[model samples]
Target chain A: MRTAAAIAALSALLAVFPFLATAPWVMTIALFTLMYAALASAWNLVGGYAGYPSLGHAAFFGLGAYTEALWFNHHGIGAGLTPFAVLPLVGLAVAAAGLPVAWIAMRTRADVFAIVTITLLFVAQTLAYNLRGITHGAQGVAMPVPDFAPATFERPFYYAMLALLVLALLLSHAVLRSRLGLALLAIRADEDKARGVGVPVGTAKLGAFALSVGITGMAGGVWAYYLSFIYPQFAVDPLVTVAMVLMVFLGGRGTLWGPVLGAFIVAPAQQYLAYQYGASQLYLLGYAALLVLVMLVLPRGVLPTLGDRYRSRQRRARTLRADVGTGVSADTGGDIAADVAGEQP
Target chain B: MSAPLLEVRGLARRFGGVAALDDCSLTVRRSTVTGLIGPNGSGKTTLFNVVTGYLRADAGQILLEGRRVARPDPARLYRRGLCRTFQQPRVFADLSVLENLLIASGRRRAALAGPRVRADDRDRAEALLAEFSLAGLADDPAEELSYGQRKLLEFAALLMSSPSLVLLDEPTAGVNPTMVRTMERHIRARHAAGTAFLVVEHDMNLVMRLCDPVVVMAGGRVIAQGPPGDVQADPLVLDAYLGG
Candidate 1:
């Protein structure tokens, strides 16, 4: 109930944020915040729940951006419902591209899986650079400008990204409660045991990969249109994947709201650094150092740490409530039945 | 009663130069708590792994209810009603105890459960928890439970699927005496309900008490077999335990 209420409150805040911030810079920051939040939520599905650290998610994001760009330019669909309509197609096509990659990467465990998945990012980067005719090489591609007034141009894209985040959160929540979620969680806990217990580990991993990258690709499409342009470097940047991973790590892994919270915390700091430093590399170094320091302090991440504190407080209360004599060690968080080894017949 | 519930014929598995299972053959008759016992280096665990589809045999035939299973795949075998436990009690430590039972609702691929947790599953998990006397810990994470409780949780988890044959590896090892009795009682109750168990345990007393027609293995082959009294008296069984 508490989690549901929190999600509802945060969602309402994001939904109403546009009207409160009329300044372009504020809206731009909000847009980036929503975009990264959506991206982080998408990454959480695979990395957080399934415990598959995919370093190549940027490849899918870049693919989505390029797909949306190509579709927009080819059809001359300038800032309309049709462009928004193509996002699903963009998501599916990129998700299909992720299938073979998932099939290969899911075969390995932990570090090897990371190594295999990171390779996809580099490959996609190479393709984007070398595909001169299709990607326009280093020159980058341009998105059709929206016909909406300049003052109001960012609203639609902002709402689009917001909608994407909500859907991604919904999907993540749905998976978390389902048997599919249970299987993924079991696989994350112990893969061999997961298989022995009748979890279809292979299928669960693949399905999650598809769903995660599919959302990421759609986010990429919205980002491309919002920016009205995309170069290979920005589209296929490794830092994008790093940011998503870090956000999830900061908030909490395998948690629904953790990534969103991380995004709200990290994206603004990142945008601020870019705003103040103006391309100076010092802040980037500082950013990395600060993030590492935070993670080292909160190894389990923010949400879980808070949950632990809450549980400890709960335990303290339980301890205080225990009466005189007839001593009951209610310490195992009220799981007293587990203490009944000799008591059972 | 004459028909074999499970049969492993001439199964051979090798780890480099060591043959873990050398022409191993055994039959678990219907409705029997069949015991597989051996010394440490013998093939008790190896046979259990191969038969449960955790490891592939070099050459063998595995027949469950008179039908041949081609290859070793744990999920597929589990759907065929062959559930197995480990030498150590391995539960999903982070999941709730009730969830550990709910996650094993897999007579088929559990991924096919789609996007919703069925209400019936929750009811079944509650019922199983109550039956195991773990209803109080249903909301607690499995990690918080003691080792003995974890073994009980694992046992209850496998029961959720209502498997015909449960291949247990060292179920009583490292557990307390009271917990051991509790496990024995549960196994007997389940056996009475028509479930067969293939228990790989090192406790001779447990084997003597729980199993019928115990099969003894030495150096990767069946050395002696019969009722516990006869097997205990067999010179070959005595020699394998004492000499090897």
Candidate 2:
């Protein structure tokens, strides 16, 4: 009940944020925050829950961006239809591209899996750079922006990003509660044991990979339209991948709100600090420092650490109640029962 | 009597130059607890692994209910109603004790996508917790449980699957006397309910008490097979295992 209430409050605040914005900068920050939230949430499906740390998610993101760019530039599809038509196509294309990669990467465990994903990022970026005719080589492709008054241009894109973030959050929540989520957690806990206990390990990993890639690809497609331009480096940037991973890590891996919380903190800080100083590299250095601090203070990430503290407090209270001859009851905050409630007997 | 629930025919598995299970053969009768006992390196664990599909055999047939399974895997074996516990209890250390049982309980891939958890699964998990004397620690992570508790937890987890043939590898290795006795009781109760077990244990007293037909192995081959008392009296088994 407390969790549900907190989520409701956060959603209400986010819904009103755009309307309450007095300046263009606030909306700009909001857009970036929403995009980062979607990206982090998408990454959480595979990396956080499945315990497959994919360093090459930028490949899929780039695939989404390039697919949208190429489709718009050559085919002129975006002009004929709304972004809703283009987004799913881009997501599917990126997911199709991710299938073979997932098959190969999911075969490996831990460090090898991470390395395989990193290799994929490098390969995708290289392909994007060298594919001169399609990608326009070093010169970036331009998006045909919808004709609208400059004052209202940000509103549609802001809402689109926000909607995507919300959908991603709900999807992540659903996955966490489902048997698929349980299998992923089992795999995360012990892959061999998960297999021994009848979990189709490969299938679970690939399913997570596909869902994560599709959502991330959708975000990338949205981002390309929002920016109205895409170069190989911009579309396939390793820095974006790092930022997403760091955000998920900082908030809490495999948690519902952790990625969003991480995104809210990191995205604005990265954007504003770089904007004020005109030193993107320096802000990245700051992100690194913050991540280091988080690792040192809260190694399991912020949300999980807080949950632990709450559980400890509940335990103490229960003990006190027991001593006082008061009946001990279920801690509403403790979700172990809820987590395990689902399963075909 | 009845057709064997599991039949291992000329099973052969090798690790480099050494054959762990060289032409090993055994049968678990329907609704009976059969025991496999041997000294260290006698290929008892190897046979269990092959049966449970953890390790592939070089050349052999594993038949469950008269049907030969080809290139068996753990999940496939599990769906076919064969479940096993490891020599070292392999509970999900990070999950709560109840969660450990729940994961093993859900049978179908479709269950992963189901929006709501089944009420019966929760009730069953709670019952298993009580049965295993782990009700108090249901919310605690499996890692926090003592070794004996983990062993019991594993047994309870296997029960959730409701497997027909349970291959228990060293079920009483580190368990306390009370747990061992509870395990025996549970085994008998399940056996009465038509679930067969092929138990691999070093505990002769447990084998004598629980198993109907004891199979003795040494040097990757079964040396003797009879009732526990007859197998215990065999000179070949005594010479191989007890160094008589």
| CAPRI docking class of candidate 1 | medium
| TM-scores of all candidate predictions against the true structure | 0.93, 0.92
- Tell me the tens digit of each residue's lDDT in model 1 across B1-244: 3457899899999999999889999998878998888888789988988888889899989999888989878888887788899999999999999889888878355445564457787788898899889999999999999999999999989887878999989899999999999999999999999999989888999999999989999889898888989999999988988993
Q: For each candidate, what's the DockQ?
A: 0.52, 0.55
Model 2: residue A310 alpha-carbon error in angstroms: 1.6
lDDT of 2 by residue, A1-345 (tens): 997898899889888876788477777878888999999999999989999999999888988988888788776756523765678888888888888889988989899988988998999999999999889878888888876556656777777788889888888888888878888989998888887788877888888898899989988888888788898998998988999999999999999889998999999988888778885488877878988998899888899999998777667655655544443344542343343333213
**Model 2, span B132-218: residue lDDT tens:** 789999989999998988888988887887789899999888878988888888788888988988899988899999998999988
Candidate 2 ranges with C-alpha deviation above 4 Å: A324-345, B1-3
Colliding pairs, model 1 = none
